[model samples]
Target: MNDQTKTQAQARNDWWKGGVIYQIYPRSFQDSDGDGIGDLNGITRRLDYIASLGVDAIWISPFFTSPMKDFGYDVSDYCDIDPMFGTLGDFDAMLAKAHRLGLKVMIDLVLSHTSDEHPWFQESRASRDNPKSEWYVWSDPKPDGTPPNNWLSIFGGPAWQWDARRQQYYLHNFLVAQPDLNFHCEEVQDALLDVARFWLDRGVDGFRLDTINFYVHDKELRSNPALPLEERNDRTAPQVNPYNHQNHLYSKSQPENIAFLERLRALTDEYEGRTMLGEVGESQRGLEILGEYTRGEHRVHMCYAFEFLENRRAIASWVVETFEKLGEVAPDGWACWAFSNHDVRRHATRWDLSDAANRAYVMLMMAMRGSACLYQGEELGLHEADVPYEALQDPYGKEFWPEFKGRDGCRTPMVWQAQDEFAGFTTSDSPWLPISPAQAEWAVDRLEEDPGSLLHHYRRAVALRHDHPALARGDQDGLTCDGELLTFTRTDGEEEIFCAFNLGDTAAHMTLPEGSWTPLAGVMSDLEAGVMDLPGWGYVIAKREGE
Candidate 1:
């Protein structure tokens, strides 16, 4: 290769620094064949539509071989594709197509654990004397034939499961079918690295590490203290499940996880430009853990927390304060921001927004400082679909019915057209998850025809991020958390952009900092109508003169 080719390769490798990643929930994105399940070919078919959104990359959720217990989170194989998705050739074809379209591809990596059906685990649990026997966390039961400790599973009940074959207990913080790896063992770490290398060698650009903090646990099996009722917040699990009552100390998020992260980082460093973004899953110290994990250049490149994806109201102050707190806690670390994902309620449903409020959040999400991840169907203002109990595939939902519905609402299939069987997503007999008729009407084809549609506004909002350096790589500053008005400035060297948002139903106003500013692309509906009056949940963008 020529020097120019090498330079171009290096640039492409550093492509994620200020990039936008569009996440594709594989099962719900598109079904190519009449199999009722979305596949690699389906993603390959939709590459043109994804590229049209002006995103720099696509982060696909888990598609590895799995039992689908946690829908693809429970991986049975690390080196091959699940028949539900497609073959290795299909994944290669999708990656090639994405690269041709100038989009990077990042696959989900479930490193903390694997499906109990995985060959490694199958071998590890068979006899206890096999070469892979120590790969998973295995322990002897207490003298009273009780669990090793009181560590509770996020799903429900004890985290430890008894295995009669090995005559010992194994740890699983999620579904009983998913066994946690003993990262405390060096051989296990080397094996996981081999799994990462398999994909890296296959030309994947990066990985979205699932449950990154759950790689290790307190080895001594110390009983976690109960959280005070007043101090408890049940965002992580079903409200009906007592899993939320205890502080998650001994179960997961152990300090030893950091050393293992360094090992993962070192492997990525070996492959020039490869990156990994960790999903930090702690209720109280989420950001603090994020900071520690990504503080140095040698660790994971970035980490995302559940803060922005929670089902809570976020005013301008809360938004600013969240980032400010992040800044204070993780000064050198990077964040990947997203309002919606497969695991949570869609932001539209959580905010209970009218269509207008939904449009405003599109602008606010893109304007925030950090890399943005746009979940599938979020651009069209898709809300949570009401999944009937009969069709619910989520075990969490089934376990905690009525009081808490699980993630089925957010996992519904994407709609591509207003008029078609399965909303033009598939010609399949039936989609794995049913599509909402209401959602089908808001499909991309219908929205594209209307110039003032939320779909068009989303394109404009995302376009703004690409047009201005301040929106993408700028430093956040001059933030004010006044009333419902959330205002801030983003500066990148000489370029400065002022941004403001009204995150409430009440009409709110804030005086602009005294300066000459040019309106680049105002996102507010009332702004263009000479109603400088900030309506409920509206945003404005202005470029300063000096900038």
Candidate 2:
């Protein structure tokens, strides 16, 4: 290869690019202390299992000190581990074990907000003249004692909460207890960067920045405009939430977020091989914001685009729209895609896919361009658990019951033992969330003993991406989502791979692209070179003759 070709190849092979990230919701992964909560030691014990999945890194959800208002997302202390999770020493052990197991540890960083109990918030709200008063977003009430503007919280009601001490209205995009940080304040940005440096100093690898697009808000605090009826979608928030009513023009997705991200990226760059994947938390403009946040160097390494994590069916056309739109908007930008995460319903239940269809998507994501994030229980084909009203935990769900059951169904404990009464997740009579009967049936122990289980299939699919350079960090082309089939090619200069998926239940067919291709084994069956017949949830990953 010439120098130019070698440089291009090197550019495509960044540590975070085209890698698979396993998202571990620490609370539900495994309970080690019989306390009914998964802690750092539990995760340390399971580092082998995570390594077994062949994922490059594990993006653990917040275990930072918090009041559990929004679980750990509402962080109280950025520098210390929550007592329920374990001490900072326990976190060090987990990190050491993960690194020893050949897995990178990327923690979820909730920089946009903090719990109301956080000292910073308390000091900021204690009085307006304090040094930390400007650390959080605070505004005066209107003449009539109404909120500053019409910005709605994702949890429900106005985004502004009246602070009695300061006699001001504070902004919170999600729950009122989770106050938004004032990123416009240079001191706040410096403090957040100092927090990043603290983690980096501790030998951590990277961060999954929560609400990357929400860091900066309109300086003038203008009211958001009303969203057109047709433009509102429930992908970001439930339909019951009037948060979807506004266009969110002044509330979020501001142009100023990029500079902050660049500063963040620069800090990460200081640590060799460290990566950052920000979450773009906008519904209508997710893709556009993703393109903006990740199109250039000195920005986030990747942004998790939410178009795939919808309640809608996982059809070919939808995939086409997302891929084509990303290609159009940010041809050079990178995306980290996931069908399921802590915030949304599991894809298996959200899309209502059959066992075979579920298998198809596992392979599809691994076969596509860019990085992929695999949720904890997705490989088990676990359906959304049935967490009744009385057992409900998610505040979002409790606010809008019946119509939207919230995310607890998806956040239930990871099923470890098929036959164990409690699925081996906890010894306590009552765990944080119930391990639903549906999830219990797909326990890891049972699948470990079964060769043909989706769990093994997930392992092989991950291996397939690792084995072939064309599948990982490759340039995708010939992409089409027609009828029931989604077809595309991934080529990394030296070789090319042809990938096809049938999202529908019934069998589907499409003429093979021009090539002498050989089907890869151990992924799916019933394959042919030409006139491919793909059964429902069936897929093919074939290599073109490389001579």
Candidate 3:
């Protein structure tokens, strides 16, 4: 490539830094052939709309060959596209189209486990004499023929399943159909590397490693101790589930995971500017794990935790403290932030909000110092729809009915047009989850014509961040925990911008830092009076004195 071409490539490839990524859940995004499931061609047809949103990239959830027990999380063939999604050729066409539109593509990779029917697992379980027999964790049950240890699965019950063929208990941290792989085996690592190389060779920009921390377990099979109620971290599972009862010492978050991550990073490093973002799900040490996973020059590029995603109305003090803790623990690490995804309730619905609160939360998320990830329909200020019990498909929701409805509400199909049948998503078949008339009214086609819509606000907010150096790629400082108001400043040398949020129900006062400043964005509440009158949830963005 020539000098100018190389420079352009560098800029285009450097899209992950401070870039906004739009996540597409393949099952609910779009259905091209109307098989009642979203497919590769469907994603290809929607690339233009994704680019129009001004997102720097697209993060697609798994579409690999699977049994769909966990809806594609349980992979049967890592190297082939599932017939439900389309063929391998279709994926390549989608990648080519996305690159043409200047959008990076990242695919979800579930390395922690595989479907029981996967060829590797099938062969491994056939007999202990097979070459791939050690690829999965198999151990003798206790004398009473019970699970070896006390590790609990996030899906409920113990994390061990008995294999009649092997006459031994195998570890499965999720559904019984999905068995955990033995990261202790070198061949297992090599096999997974080959799977990753298959995609890299196919021209994918990066990967989002699902349950990255769960790749290994404590070899000693130690039992995890109970967590005190006051000491419990509330971000792991639903409040109604007992999965949060333990400290999680044995099942996952093993130190051995770092070496495997380093290996994956080395693979990505072969292709210049390629990236990897791991999903760290530990409740107590999630941010710390994020730091460890992304720390140093040889590890993954970034990682995300459930901190902000779990807490809907996160306090101003909590935000400041969490970032501060991240800096102190893992300074070299990068973070990817999001408020909603296929796995959780939408933040707009989780946090009961009025007009001001809704607007402020969006600004706060965009302003945070990191790469941002926006879920589909978030730009339209969409809230989660209440799914009837009969319509719920999420296993978690089915298991924990009335009290804890599953994630089906947030996984509804995207709405494209206000008046079109099925919201212009698909014409021939019904969506996996029903669409809300309220949500359909906020469709992209309708919002595109209205200048004052939430879509416009999102575009402007993202543009402002892109234009301001202080807001993008800047050092964070001046964080103060003042009563209900949390204030902080982001700076890049000569430029600085102050940000404050009123994370409470009543008004609070905040004194400006020694000099005159200009209001930047999300100027919802008034700033004239010495005592700032912040009504409930309010936010302010101000630039420092002078230039």
After superposition, the stretches of candidate 3 with alpha carbons farther than 4 Å from their true spots are 1-14, 504-507, 524-538
- TM-scores of the models, in the given order? 0.96, 0.96, 0.94
Candidate 1 lDDT tens digits, 1-547: 9999997997666667667899999999989987888899999999999998889889999999898999999999899999989999999999999999988899999988899999999999999889988899999988999988888888888899999999999999999999999998899999889999999999988999999989998888888999888856655765577887888887888889888899888888888778898898888788998899989887888899988887776767778788888989999888888889888888888878888788778888778888889999988889899999999999988888777788999989899989886898888767898889989768999988999988888888888998887888789887777788888999888888888888888877656666777787655344333336676876778887765
**Candidate 3 TM-score over all chains jointly:** 0.94
Worst 10 residues of 3 by lDDT: 522-531
- Measured by lDDT, the strongest candidate is 2
Question: What digit string (tens of lDDT, one per residue) describes model 3 on residues 416-525?
Answer: 88998788777765777787777887898999999988888788777777777667668878777777688788898899988887777787777767666778775534
lDDT of 2 by residue, 284-322 (tens): 988888888888888988997679888887688988888
Worst 10 residues of 1 by lDDT: 522-531
What C-alpha RMSD separates each model from the true structure?
A: 2.5, 2.2, 2.5
**Cα deviation of 317 in candidate 3 (Å)?**
1.6
Candidates 1 and 3: which is better by lDDT?
1
CA lDDT of each candidate? 0.86, 0.88, 0.84
Better of 1 and 3 by TM-score: 1
